[model samples]
Every structure is written in structure tokens, then in C-alpha cells.
Target: MQTTLRRPVALSGIGLHTGRPARVTISPAAAELGIWFHRTDVKAADPYIAARWDGVEQVPLCTRLVNEDGVSVSTVEHLMAALAGCGVHNAMIEVTGPEIPILDGSAAAFAQAILGAGVRRLDTPVRALRVCRPVEVAGPGGALARIEPAEGLSIAFEIDFADAAIGRQRLSLDMGNGAFVRELCDSRTFCRAADIDRMRAAGLALGGTLDNAVVVEGDRVLSPGGLRHSDEPVRHKMLDALGDLALAGAPLLGAYTGRRAGHALTNGLLRALFATPGAVEWVECDAECQRRLPGMGVRLADLAAVA
Candidate 1:
């Protein structure tokens, strides 16, 4: 069965790059609506942006979606991961600003909020994008992403950096058994300290601070309290890939492998998957497939320790 929120869930915080305060409400939508965002602050023309790969307009530091009228919603990946990981099939998300809140730089807060607000099943059946063949996209160096047919949604991620503290890390996990909630929810976005100046020069990263993101310097972690996981950077990358892939407009039943990939590469992978004929097909998921999704058997307290 498909699902949506029983009641609207609200979240408020500062946008990571825009540095603007914003509030967002995620309300239940009728079955088949998928996830869409409305810019409540935009008083003119169209104020909505469908949260899909086709709606994506930018992928520099985060995923940004723009409507036909050129109105945009920025930094939507974390909230997206929260919705997808929670098995939310339909939602009406309204934000009072241009960007969604950064929220501890992870999807944990959003996950906790949704679990608290609760979910209700809809009468409509759940739909998922099932990969039918191997699809891949590549970038300079070794950055790449690939998807292949699989029985369940799984992620294989590998990241390497010159920093000794984050040299090389790899993780592969089947998303069943609340693994997303228990394992990947709290890994925060990270950046190299050397990039801060360049980002500021480009008039970005205005809201980044030591409190919300992990800042790394050479081989040392500049973020206070260090990492929640020894391989947190790579885990965060996987979390991002899941979020970006959620733009497929439904749950995906496939195996995703990301090798040193970021937002752009992940988005490209989705484009390639959809552009290639017979690469993907929509399937009405059976109970068995549904049971193996990211949030199958998830509990609010699954990540209580991390929370």
C-alpha cells in the first residue's frame, strides 16, 4: 500500500547557503501526487516545483528545483531523503522561503519529525521504479554512478580523499530493516576548509558554521566532537545519493553504486537511467518488495541513541 502523513509536520530553521530563516510543512497528499514543494513566500506567478529529476535546475552544492516560471526551491536533498527513507509516497511540502532548512545537516531531524507526526496508509497501491538493466554515468577522474536490477533497494558507495582521516571508505547496505534510520540518518554534510574562501567568493555558504556541518582541514576534522561514524563522509555521500535518486518520483527498486559521486553525478545517473529505453520500468510493488524498502519495520526510536 502507499502512504502519506496523517497530519502536517512542521520544521523551521536557517537555510544553509541562503542564510535565511524558513519554515516548512509536510502535509498528506492524495495518492499519486508524489512529493511537490510550494514556495509560500513567492507571491507572484507559479509557486510550485515538482520534486523530480526534470524539475532539477542546479546541482552545485545541493539539489535545487525550479518551476517553469523560474521560481526555485533550494537544498532539498536532506528532506527528500527523509521522505523517501520513511516510505512516504505522497506529500505536499510548503516552504516559507527559497531554501529548505539545513537541520543539523542531516535527515535525522526530519526523520524524527515524521515519525512523531506519524504516517497513514492510503487506498492506492504503491508504485516503484524498477531497474531493468545496468545504467551508468561518469565524470572527470573516477566519479561515477550506476544502477542495476536488484531484488531490493541497495546502495554501494565508495569515497576517497587525499585527507588521511578520510582516505578511503566503502559501505554497501540493503535498505531493509530500518537501516536508513539506524545507520545513515545522522551523517552530516562535510566540506574542506580550503573551499570555504572560494565558496564565500561565489557568495555562497553564508549559513555554514561549525555547528551544522563537518569542516575538515587537511587530515584533521575541524568539526567539534569529530564524527558520529568513523566513515561518516562516505555514509553521508550515500545518504545524498538516496536523496537525489528519490527524485525519480517514487521509491526505486534497484542497486545503486556511487564511486566518488556527488549531487551532479547522481542526478546525471538518474537522467541516463530514464533517457535509456528499457533501462527502467514502473512496477506495482508486491508486499514482499514493499517489505524490503528503506523504512520497512522502521520505528521512531530506531535512531534514538544518535538523536
Candidate 2:
């Protein structure tokens, strides 16, 4: 069965790149609506932007969705991940600004809210994208993203950084059975100290603070209280991958592998997946198949074990 929020939930914070304050509300929608964004502030232009891969506009650091009227919303990956991770199939996200909040630089707050608000099962059967064969995309600097046949959605990620505090890290996880809530939800986004100035020079990361994102400098972790997990960077990468993959607009039963891939590469991989014929097929999930999908058995109590 498909699911939607039992009630509306609202969150507020500053945007990571825009550095502007915004308030967002996640409201339940009818079955098959999938996920969409409405810019409440836009009065003259079309404010509705489909949260689909085709609407994605390649941007640095985060995923941005632009509608046909040029209306857009940015930094949507975390919220999207929370929705997908919580088994939310239909939602209308209302935002007052051009970006989603960067709350805690992870999906924990979003997941907690959705779980607390409760998920209501819809009458319609859930449909999923089943990867039939290997489809891959490569970006500059050797970044790679690939998807292949799998019984359930799983992620394998590897990241390497020059900063000693975050050198090489790798992790793989089967995202079914609330594993996302247990293992990946609390991992915060991270970056090296050396990149801060560069990002600011590009007019980005303006709202970034030590409280929201994990900051590392050489061998030291500048973010207070350190990481939530030993391999938090890689875990966060998986989290982002899940969110980007969610743009498929359906539950995906496939194994995703990322090697130094970011938002753009993942979106590219989706574009490639849909463009390549015979690479994927749409199938209505059976009872057993639904059981294997992410968020199938998620419960509010799952939050107790998360950071």
C-alpha cells in the first residue's frame, strides 16, 4: 500500500546555500500524487515543481528542482530522503522561500517529525521501479553512480578525502526494515575546513555553522561533540544517494553503488537509467515485494535508537 502523512508537519530553519530563513510544511496528498513542492511566496509565476528527476537542475552541493515556469526550490535532498525513507508516497511540500531548511544537516529531524505525525496507508497499491540491468553514469573527477538488479533497495558508498579527520570510508547497507532510520538518519553532512572559504567565495554555505554540519580540519574535527558515527561521511553519502534516487518518483528495488558521487552524478545516473531502454521496468509491488522496500516496517520507536 502507498502511504501519506496522517497530518501536516511544519519545520523552520536556514537554508544551507541561500542562508535565508524559510518555513516548510509537509502536507498529505491523495494517492499517486508522489512528491511536489509549492512556493507559497510566488504569486505571479507557477509555483508547483514536481519533485521528479526530470525537473532536477544540476547544481553544486545540493539538488534543485525547477518547474517549467522557472520556479525552483533548492537543497531538497534531506527532506526528500526523509519522505522516501519513511515510506511517504504522496506529499505536497509548501515552502516560503527558494530552499528547504538545512536542519542539523541530516534527515533525523525530518524523519522524527514524519514518524511522530504518523504515516497513513492509502488504498492504492504501491508501484516500484525495478532495475533490470546495469545502468551507470560518470562525472568529472572520476565520480561514479550505478544501479543494478537487487531484491531490495541497497546502497554501497565509498568516499575519500584529503583531510585526515575524514580520509577513506566505505559502507553498504540494505535500506529495508527501517535501517535508514537506525543507521543513516543521524549522520550529518561534512566538509573540510579548507573548502569553507572557497564555498563562501562562491556565495554558498552561507548558513553553515558548526552546529549543523560536521567540519573537519586536518586531523581535528572542528564540529563540537564530533561525529555521530565513525564513518558518518560515508553514511551521509548513502543518505544523500537515497534522497537523490527518490526523485525516481517511485520506490526503487535496486542496488545503488556510489564512488565519490555527489548530487549531480546521482541525478545523471537517474537520467541515464530512464534514457537507457530495457534498463528498468515499472511493476506493482506484491505483498512480499512491498515488505522488502524501505520504510515498510518503520515505527516511531525507531527514533529511540537514533542519535
Candidate 3:
């Protein structure tokens, strides 16, 4: 069955790129309404932006959504991932700024909040996009994103960085049975220490600090505390892939492999998947199929083990 939050939950923090304080409230919605964002600060025109792959606007360093009226909300992946992992099928995210708050730079906080608020099942059966054929997107700099047929949702990711501390990490996981809450939620986003200055010059990561993201300078970690996982970088990549894939507007029953891919490439893969004929089909999940989907049988106690 589809699910929605039992009650509205709110979080506030500084935006990573905009350097402005923002507040976001995740509210319940009816089944099939899908995930959406409404910019509360925009009073002149339509402030609504659908959290779907087709609404994505290619930008540097984050996942952004823009409506037909040119209203936009940036840095949505973490929140989106939390919604997907918590088995939330419909929500209305109300934000007070141009970007979602960069709370801890991971989905842990979001997941914890949603789980605490509780998930309520709707009467309708859950639906998922099942990959019928292979769909691949090649990004610049040898980045690649691909999806193939799979019985359940799975993600495998590889990332190689010049920084020795984060060089060549790889991992894969079947994202069922609350695996996302246990494995990937706490993995914070990371970047090369050397790139910080360049990014600041390019007007990005303005609100970034050691508290939110892990910073690596060659073999050394500059963040105040060490990593939550030994291969934190790769796990974070997998978390990102899950978030981007959530934009499909429904859970996906497919195996996703990302080779040094990011937001743009993942969105490209979705576009390619929808454009190709007979490449994908929507199916209403049955009892057995629901068991194979992520978040099936998930419990609030799942948060007790997460860090």
C-alpha cells in the first residue's frame, strides 16, 4: 500500500549553496499525489514544483527543480531520499527559501524525523516502475549511469577521487528491508579539500563547514570527526543515487549502477528510460512484490541502530 506521514514534520538549517537560513515542513498528502515542493517565500506566481525527474534543472553540485513559472527549489536530493526510504508515496514539502536546508549533509536527520512522525498506509496498492530493458546515460568525464531489469531495487556505486583519503571506493546493496536506513542514511556528502577554494570562487558551498560535509585533503580528513563508515564516500554516492532515482515519481524495481555519476547523469538516465519505447512499465505491487520493495516491513525501531 502507499504511505503518507502521520503528521507534519519540520526542519530548519542553513542552505549549502545559498548560505541562507531555510525551513522546510514535510506534510502528508493523499495517495498518488506524488512528492511536491511549494516555495513559501514566493508570493507572486506559482510556487509549486513537482519532485519528478522531468522537473529537474541541470545544475552544478545539487538536484534542483524548476516549475513552468521559473520558480525553483534547490538541493532536494537528501529530503527526497528520506521520503523514498521511509516508504512515503505522497508529500507536500513546504520550503521558505530557494534551497532545502542542508541539515547534516545526509538523509539521517530526515529519515529519523519521518519515522518518528510515523508512516500511515493508504488503501491503494503501491506501484513501481519496472525496467524492461537496459537504459544507460554517459556523462562527461567518463561518468556513467545505467539501469537494468531486477526483481527488487538495488544500487551499486563507484567513486574515484584524486584525494587519497577518498580514492576508488565501491559498494552495492539491495535497498530492501530498511537497508537504506541502516546503511546509507548517515553517510554524509564529501568533497576534496583542494576544491573548496575553487568552489567558493564559483559561488558554491558557501555554507559548507566541517559539521555538514567531510573534507579530504589528499590522505588526510579535515572534518572535525572521522567518517561514520570507512568507505563513507562511496556510501554517500549510493545515497545520492537513491535520491535521484526517487524522482521517477514511483519506486523503481531495477538495479542501478553508477560509475562516478552524480545528479545530472542520474536524471539523464531517467529521461532516457522514459524516452525509449517499451523500456519500462508500471506495475501495481502485489503482496509478494511489496515484500521485495524497499521500506517493506520497516519499523520505527529501525532508527535505533542508525548513526
Off by over 4 Å in 3: none
**Candidate 2 regions off by >4 Å?**
none
* Per-residue accuracy of model 3 over 41-74 as CA lDDT, tens digit each: 9999999999999999999999999999999999
Pitting candidate 2 against candidate 3, the one with the higher lDDT is 2
lDDT of 1 at 22: 95
lDDT (0 to 1) per candidate = 0.90, 0.94, 0.93
Per-model TM against the reference: 0.98, 0.99, 0.99
Which rank order by TM-score, best down to worst?
A: 2, 3, 1
Q: Which ranges in model 1 have alpha carbons more than 4 Å from their true place?
A: none
Show the colliding residue pairs in model 2.
none
> Candidate 1, which ten residues in sequence have the lowest lDDT sum?
294-303
Better of 1 and 2 by lDDT: 2
Task: Give the per-residue Cα lDDT of candidate 2 at 240.
Answer: 97
Candidate 2 whole-model C-alpha lDDT, 0 to 1: 0.94
Give the Cα-based TM-score of candidate 1 against the true structure.
Answer: 0.98
